[model samples]
Target chain A: MKSRIFVTLKNGVLDPQGKAIHHALEGLGFAGVSDVRAGRLIEIEHDENVSKADLEEMSRKLLANMVIENFEIESN
Target chain B: MRAAVIQFPGSNCDRDMAVALRDVMGADTSLVWHRESELSDGLDFIAIPGGFSYGDYLRSGAMAARSPVMQAVIAAAGRGVPVLGVCNGFQILTEAGLLPGALMRNAGIRFVCRKVRLKVENSQSIFTSHYDADEEITIPVAHHDGNFFADEATLDRIEGEGRVAFRYAEPVNGSARDIAGILNDAGNVLGMMPHPERMIEAMQGGSDGRRLFQGVMEGLIREIA
Candidate 1:
């Protein structure tokens, strides 16, 4: 199975890197960008026996810091 | 008194921490590597020093937090052993769930490296007993992801409980509530961005941080005496 996890800062958390990217875009003359947020994507290759529960546990235990971030797992 | 300074693979300040504890705090100290699953018995103090642990991979301190030695440290903390986490160590403690919240990028999105002024918020903790409450002190803070973040309710609770040990006297990082350091609910674990170990001597520009270590040593020694 292959799984993809998207880890992002929780809502209302400050995203400094994303804000910096927005600034760079504006400097390059881009417009209409109201807000920006940054996150991480992690892809995993695993055995077919890996279950959704396992993936979720992995995300909870290590992939995402639940205090300030959330993780969504998509596996097939 | 005896102390253990944990040394992760990328830890640069382990020796410095060891020296401060041994020389300044007058405790026998040893450097414990991250891979060691168990710490020797009779450790009076544990310190996680600052550095780019695990190369700051996955997230600052994420990988290092899950390493074998942290389990022992966590167990020790549960037993009321005093633990101090500085800079990258602070990040690791949060990642390991020994401390609350997470450290994010600085609001300015820059690696803040300089001596910063901090106000001692709680002079009652073993970590701060030597300092007067609200006393301002200068310490060196060198980190990229030192911006502390926690939800409003969590922030309120920590603040209300007086768990906040230190707060930035000036705008240095975009830390929520300007908290530079905090103690865990058990009051045994402390996570702070500023490097107290680096400022233990006059040549380090100031000895303000010396009192912090001094307090812990005195507090622990008193119990034994």
Candidate 2:
């Protein structure tokens, strides 16, 4: 099975890269732009024996930093 | 004093840390690779130096924190060994759960590399014992992600407990409350963004960083004696 993990900064945390991207978009004359936040996506392949709990544990242990980020696991 | 400088694959500052400790501070130092599961027994101090460990692949210090050698380092810290993490090392400490808070991307969205001023916060700790209360010093910081962040409650608790070891005298990286360095609850582990090892001598522009290693070595000698 293949799964994708999305890691994102938690609410109220500042996203500088996202902000810079937004500024660059405005400089390019893009209109009605809202705020932007940066995050990461990790794709992993595991045996079918792997369960959702295992993936969650993986996310908690390494894929996401619990202090500043949250992670969601999606199975493909 | 016997010290171990942890060296990750991309660690460029390990030699600087060893030189500062061995030559200036007069401690016998060794560079321990990240893959080793064992550190030298009876280590008085361990240092995590600055660099782009693991090429900063996932996050600064994230991959290195989970490497084998860190477990040994963590065990040593549990036994009250002094551990100092600078720059990327600071990020690894936080990632390894040895210190509180996460170092985020700089608020200005740029890689900061320059000498910045810092004020000693808790000099009573072993790490800052050589510094006077609220004394200002200059140290160099070079990182893209030195901005420190934690929740308000954790911030209040650590501040109330005097776990903060240093604060930026100026807003250099937009760190929360301008925090530059912090100590663990036991006060044996200190992680700071500034590179104290680099500033250990006058040729490096100033020698204010010398006292940090000096103080720790003295403290260890006293303990051993």
Candidate 3:
């Protein structure tokens, strides 16, 4: 079994990297760019017995910093 | 005062911090590696020295925060031991949940290295007791991700709670409200982007940073007495 975690800066958090990326897009002549917020994705491979709670705990412990980032988990 | 300096793989300033604490403050200091599961007992203070920990891989201090030794440091912090995080250490503290906010990329997207003026916002804390409030002091900051970020409410709360320890007098990085350093709610943990360890001596161009260690040492002596 494998689980994927998406880590994103919370709403209202400033992401300068994402903004720079947005500006780079504009500089390269790409128009209609809305906004950019940088984030991370982690894929975890676990055994079949691994539960959602375990993955959530993983995210809370190491994958996401609750002070600034929010994380969601999806198993497939 | 007994202090421990946590050393990560790429921690270049651990020795500098140790020398500052040992020579300037005369504190009994030890260097603790990241793999250690337990810190030496009865530690009065812990200094997370600045450097590109883990080569600043996957965000500054991100990998180091999960190292085994951090658990002991976090435990010591919860026990009310003073923990000071400078530069990359600041990022580790935030990553360890010891402090709020994140040190993002510099607004100019370049590594800034120079002496910058900082305002002593609150001199009452154990870390800044030797300085007067609103005093302008120069400290060196060298980092690529020293831009501090927090939401408005949290920023206001941090300011309201008197947790803003050091404020940059001028814009060095694009930190929110020019916050250069801050303390945790319990007042035991401090995370700041400026490198106080770099400015502890007159030969270092300024001695403004020496007072922080002196203040903390005095506070620890008083506590021990």
**For residues B153-172, what per-residue lDDT tens digits would candidate 1 score against the true structure?**
99999999999999999999
Tell me the spans in candidate 3 whose CA falls farther than 4 Å from its real position: none
What TM-score does each of the candidates earn?
0.98, 0.98, 0.94
Question: Which order, best to worst by DockQ?
Answer: 1, 2, 3
Candidate 1 vs candidate 2, lDDT winner: 1
Top model number, DockQ: 1
Interface RMSD of each: 0.5, 0.6, 1.6
Order of the predicted models by lDDT, top scorer first: 1, 2, 3
Candidate 3 lDDT over B1-225, as tens digits, reads: 788999999999999999999987898888999999999788989999999999987779999999999999999999999999999999999998889888988988889999899999989999999999999999989999998988888999999999999999988889999999999999989898888888888888988899998899899989989
lDDT of 2 by residue, B83-194 (tens): 9999999999999999999998999988999999999999898888899989999999999999999999989999999999999999888898899999999999999999
TM-score of chain B of 2: 0.98
- What tens digits encode model 1's per-residue C-alpha lDDT throughout A1-76? 7899999989999999999999999999999999989999999999988889999999999999999889999887
The true-versus-predicted C-alpha distance at residue B209 of model 3, in Å, is 0.7
Best by lDDT: 1
